[model samples]
Target: MGSNRTNFRVIGLFLLLISMLLFAGGCNNKNNVLSAKQLTDNTPLTVKVLDVGQGDAILIRGGGQVILIDTGDVPDRDKLVSFLKSEKITTIDKLIITHPHADHLGGFAALVGQFAIKQIIDSGQITTTALFRQYLTAAQKKQIAFTVASEGDQFDLGSGILLRVLAPGKPLLTGTDSDLNNNSIVLRLTFGKFSMLFAGDAEQVEETQILKKYSREMKSTVLKVGHHGSRTSSSLPFLAAVAPEAAVISVGLNNDYHHPHPSILKRYEKQKTTVFRTDLHGTVTIAINGENYTIMREKGENAK
Candidate 1:
């Protein structure tokens, strides 16, 4: 009887050890599954066009670099910051002011205060408006590396991603009658066979200038519709020149500017290009890999 009791105790102890091992193995398996999911979800390149409503703010992530183009107006600063945080961006490699327009540069002051800015690029034309002056002051105090980007200037951010300046061949005279919208900085970004054009509030005059200077069609896979799709921009000739598969217009809903004019919308339809609008869809993100591109809207579904 003593031998039997001792054997029974040993068996119970073995069973407990097996149960503990099973529990630990189950936990480890669960952890491994979660890690695999996370690895699959992370994207290599992401372009997020934040919705500031009637303003422009686009974030580009590629080749281990982050580039921010135009912060929206003042009221949208918090939202922009939140979006950056959500994306796990700790510093800005490049900050580009497309133009001196209030809507484009209004949030720069706040952004400079919030994050580490490595460099800044602008048209380098000072403005008389207080908001514009504030942006200049903040940039100066931060001692952010500054440069005036001209047509043809190119830089590589990583993974074969290239940003090429495409507008404002020369600085415009300050306080001149020439429309600021026409002087807006245009950028063309290319990754492999996919490319996108960001025309910052540029109007017909600027488009005409680009056409004359380049003497080539502005072909891109995606086109950020100019002047928020106003009738003043996105000329039919320019549209034909680009021949993009997709177009995005960043504008406000019910804005007084009457942006995304019906005429412009009809023109895009005529070309059979898919159109996305921030005014109606909120933030729009475009992800490109090699020759493939995918678009995701904040309010709508993703399209590839």
Candidate 2:
């Protein structure tokens, strides 16, 4: 009789363990992408468009969390690490890789060596470069929770800041000149009355599709000019839909590609949008407290 009672107790505990496992899984599947559980303290939302010349490396801080989107190029990895260290950022709550391009994913090696990245959100686009292979291997070695962002995926970055993936849905953009760049992950970060559109090198091809789908929802206070303001991006329709009060172009000062192309610059000028370039501004900082916001350049005149 004692033996039977012992068996019964074991069965009950097994059931309880299973129940806990199921509950935990359900919670994890809720968002499925990013993770930030801390509540807000009503502090200002700040995004530093780091001047990682010729590439993108944005530092988003808010809701008691530090998130990095894109990590410049191979040549700029050490610079990125130094800048983050200066800001006292050691643990990255989330690291977002817009796509697997050399200029975007090259800094992963440096980041992995320095920061304790809790989670990683990627575009899931494959590339056949040595750098790309190393990127995947490193992620596996780090054992970080990796997620492939899809359209309509919404992640709460605490403090009521909501980031919505707006592009790179199923059957990723193909048959393009540069499918990698065209299918780059496009994210719209919304917080209170301020919003910013981040299209990681998404050229006109992808822009057309996104504009058609999220046109009504694309209006933002700031637009991170696509493809570093190359002529291939910043389509007229896209610019009109976003209609941002300020636009930031992340590019090198004397890049061979001649980024922030004269033609694209004219478009921003025609729209009467205030332009901020990391090359000239040093590091562009955008601060938002509830409904009011300000754009302060690190060196150039602080903008509104």
Question: Best-fitting candidate, measured by TM-score?
Answer: 2
Estimate TM-scores for all models.
0.83, 0.84
Span of ten consecutive residues with least summed lDDT in model 1: 30-39
User: What digit string (tens of lDDT, one per residue) describes model 2 on residues 76-190?
Assistant: 9999999999989889998999998878887999999989999999998998899999988998998999999989998898889988999887779899988999888999999
Q: Indicate the TM-score of model 2.
A: 0.84
Native-to-model Cα distance after best TM-score fit, residue 93 in candidate 1, in Å: 0.6
Local distance difference test scores for all models: 0.82, 0.87
For all the candidates, what are their Cα RMSDs to the real structure? 12.1, 19.4
What is the model-wide C-alpha lDDT for candidate 1? 0.82
